[model samples]
Target: MAILFRRVALVQLAPRLGDVEYNLNLIEHGVQRARAQSAELVVFPELAVTGYFLKDMVSTVALRIDGPEVARLASLSRGLELIVGAVEESEDYRFFNSALYFRDGELTYIHRKVYLPTYGLFDEARYLARGDRIRCFSSALGRTAILICEDLWHPSTAYIAALDGAVALVCPSSSPLRGISEGKDHDDNAAYWELLNAVYAQTFGVFVVYVNRVGFEDGVGFWGGSEIVSPVGNRLAKAKYYEEDFVVADLSLKEPRRQRVQAPLLRDENLDLTIRELQRIQRCRGTLGHQECGESHADCEGETDAGLEER
Candidate 1:
C-alpha cells in the first residue's frame, strides 16, 4: 500500500482585541499563504478570531455556528482543511470557547473547550460554558481530535481521544509566559507545554500539533512556541517564542501505525475493566442506604479496598 503524506501549517499570529474583522482578514491571509505552499491542513491558535483576554467582550464578539463569518471562513477553506479557534454563541446566547474545522467549503466538526481554567491569570469559566464531550472525528488527514487550551492539561481528555482512535491530536492554546526556567530556551509555560506534547505523543503513539498565539493583551504576554511532535515524541517543527510565525511540516500517516505496533499501548488498554473500577470508586462514596444492601458493610469496605488495589 502507498503511504499517505500531508503538509500541515501552524499559524501563530497576534489577534487584535475584540476585532473580528481584522482577525478574520489575518486568518484569511494566513490561509492563502499556507495554500500557496501547498499545505493540506492549517491550524491556528486558540481564540484566533476573537483574541483571548476578552473578559466581557466574549459574549459580544461570539459567532454563531452558522453565522455569516463562519460562512466566509468556509468559503476561504475551499480545498484545504482549516482549524481555527473562536468564541461560539449558542442559540440561547450562551458562549463557548470553540475550535471549528472547515474543509471543502463546509464546516466539518466543532470541538468546544471542555476545561475552562478560572485560576490565576485565567478566568474562562466566568465567560464561557464548558463543553461536555470529547471524541475523535474523521478528517481529511485521517482520524483526528481537537483539544482547546486547558483541555490538554487534563490527561483523561487526551486518553479518551486516543481510545476513540485518534491518530493525530491538535491543540490550540493562548498560554501566557509565566516565570523563567533556567538554562531553557523558553519560559516555564512553554517548557511545560513541550513536556505535555511529548508525553502525549509518546504515550498514545500519535502525532501532536500545538499552536499558540503571541502578543501582549492587558499587560499579559502570550508565548508563541507552537510545535509539531511526531508519534515517537520527536520535535519535528517549532516556531519562535514571543513572535508571530507561520510554520509548516509534512507528516506521514504511517508513523502512528508504526509507533503503535512498537509500543502497543492502545491494544493493551482495558476499557470495560476501567469503567467497572470507576463505578466501584463512585459507589464507595457511602450514601444513605449503603449498609442495608445485600452485600453487607464488609463487602462495601472491600469494594473500596479492591478499587484501590486495582489502581
Candidate 2:
C-alpha cells in the first residue's frame, strides 16, 4: 500500500493582515477547491493565518495548537493532508512562527522558524522564539520535513532533514520581493529562491515543495512564484507571481528513488565524519567540552573539514 503518486496543491494566497477570521475563510475555500480537484495534499505559505509584518499585532492573532483555530484547521483534514502556518503561542506564553502539518485530521508535526532574520524590513527575532530541532515525520506522502521561512536559508536544516531520511522538504515562507529593477519582470530575490529550491532538490535527491505568499503587507510586496521542484532539479509546477493562484502538481515517489539511484549524493553523505568535524569545530571555538571534542583549542588546531572551510 505504498503511495507512489499523488496530486499536491500550492495555495499561493495573500492573507489580510491581522485578520484571522478572514484568513480562515480563505483557507477553508482553498481546501474545498483543492479537494474538489482531487488533490491529496494542500500547502500554504508561512504566517498564512495572521499574515506577515504583524509588528505589534502578532500576539493578537496568535493561536494555540489546541485552540479553536487549529481545531478548525485540523477539521479540514478528514481525507486530504494539509500544511499551514500560524503564530503559535506556547504554554509559557512565548510565540513562535510555526508550520503545522496535519494528517487524518490530527496535528502531527509543528516546525518553528529557527533562524529569525532581524535586519532591514525583517524583524522576526524581536517577537518569536527559535525552534531547536529539524526532524522528518511520516504522512500519507511518506517522509517529509517542514522548514518555515528563513529556515531554508540555513543549509544545515535541510541537510539534517535529508540525513534523517526525508523524501520531501516542505518549506513555507513569507519572503518579500526585493531588488526590483526597471526592466526586469521578476524580483532579484525570486530568482535566487528558485536557484535555492533547485539546488536543494537536486543535491538531496528530495522533492522540494516550496510554498510562498503573494501580495502586499505594510507596503512590501511578496512575489508569489511558488514552485515545486523535482528531485533532479526540474521545475514541476509554478504559480503566478504577485497574485493569488492555486496550482497542482502530480508528483511520483519513483522520481526521488530514480534520482537517488542516478546521482547518489545523499548516499555518499558521511554522517559520522560530519559529526566528528562539527565536534572538532565546536571544540576549536571553545563551545564543546573536553569529553566530546578536545580539552583545548591547541589540541584541535590542526583538525579541519573541507566542507567547513568551503562554507
Candidate 3:
C-alpha cells in the first residue's frame, strides 16, 4: 500500500512591528484559510507573532511561553498543526527567539533559536538569550525539528536533528534582501538560501520547509521566498518574493525513507569518532604557539584528527 501524502501550507506575511494583537490576528486568519484548504500543517515565518527588526522593542514585546497569547494560538491549532515564531520570555525575564509548535489545541514543542546573529544589520544577541539545546520532537506531521533563521546556517544543528531521527526540518526566517546577483535575476541572499535548503534536504534525506517574511522595516526589506524541498532535494513549491503569499504543497512521508535507503549517509555516520575529534580540536586552542596540552605541532602528526576529510 502507498503512503498517503499530507498537505502543508507556508504562510508568508509581513507583520506589523511591535503590534502583537495585529500579528496574532493575521496568524489566526492564515490558520483559518489553511484549514479551509484541508492542510494538515501550517508554517509561518520567523517572529510572525512579533515582527522582526525589533531592536529595543524585543524586551517590551517578549511573551511568556504559557501566556494568554500563546494559549490563543494553541486554541486556533485544533485538528491541524501550526509552527510559528515569536519572542519567548523565560521565568528569569531573559528573552529568546523561539518557534512554537501547536497541535490539537495544545503546545507540542518549542524550539528556541540557538544562534543569534550579531553582525551587520542584525543585533539579535543584544536583546535575546541563546538557546542551549537542539533536538527533534514527534509531531502530527511525523518526527520534526525547528530551526529559526540563522540557526539553519550552522550545519551541526541540522545534522544533530537528523541524527536524532528527524524526518522533516522546518525553518522560519526573516532574512533581508541585501545583495543582488550579477544577472539581476534573484537576490544573492535568496540564491544562497535555495542552495542551503537543497543541500540540507539532499544530504540529510529529510524534508526542508523554509518560510520567510516579506516587507520593509526600518529601511531593511525582507525577501519572501518561502519554499518546500523534498527529501531528494526537489523544489516542490515556492512563494513569490516581496509579497504576502499562501502556498501549499503535498509532501510524501515515504520520500525520506526512500532517499535514506538509497543514500544511507546518516546510517553510516560515525558519531563516536566525530565526538573524539571535536574534543581534540577543542583542546588544541593556545596562544603564542603554545598548545594547551603542551604538545608541539610535530607531536600531533601521528594522531588521526577527525577533520572534514573524514566525512
TM per prediction: 0.92, 0.91, 0.93
lDDT of 3 by residue, 1-311 (tens): 97869899999999999999999999999999999999999999999999998988998888887789999999999999999999999999989999999998999788999999999999999989999999888875588999999999999999999999999999999999989767766698989999999999999999999999998998889889999999988899899988999999999889999999999999999999999877766665433155444555643442435465686
Count of backbone clashes, every candidate in sequence: 0, 0, 0
- Tell how far residue 145 is off in model 1, in angstroms: 0.7
- lDDT per residue for candidate 1 within 62-131, as digits (tens), equals 9998889999999989998999999999898889999999997999899999999999988999999999
What residue runs in model 3 are displaced by over 4 Å at the alpha carbon?
286-311
> Per-residue lDDT for 80 in model 1?
89
How close to the true structure is residue 145 of candidate 2, measured as C-alpha lDDT? 92
TM-score of 2: 0.91
Off by over 4 Å in 2: 1-3, 181-183, 286-311
RMSD of 1: 3.9
In order, the Cα lDDT scores of the candidates are 0.92, 0.89, 0.91
List per-candidate RMSD values in Å: 3.9, 4.4, 3.2
Check candidate 1 and list the clashing pairs. none
Over 4 Å off in model 1, which ranges? Answer: 285-311
Choose 2 or 3, whichever is better by TM-score. Answer: 3
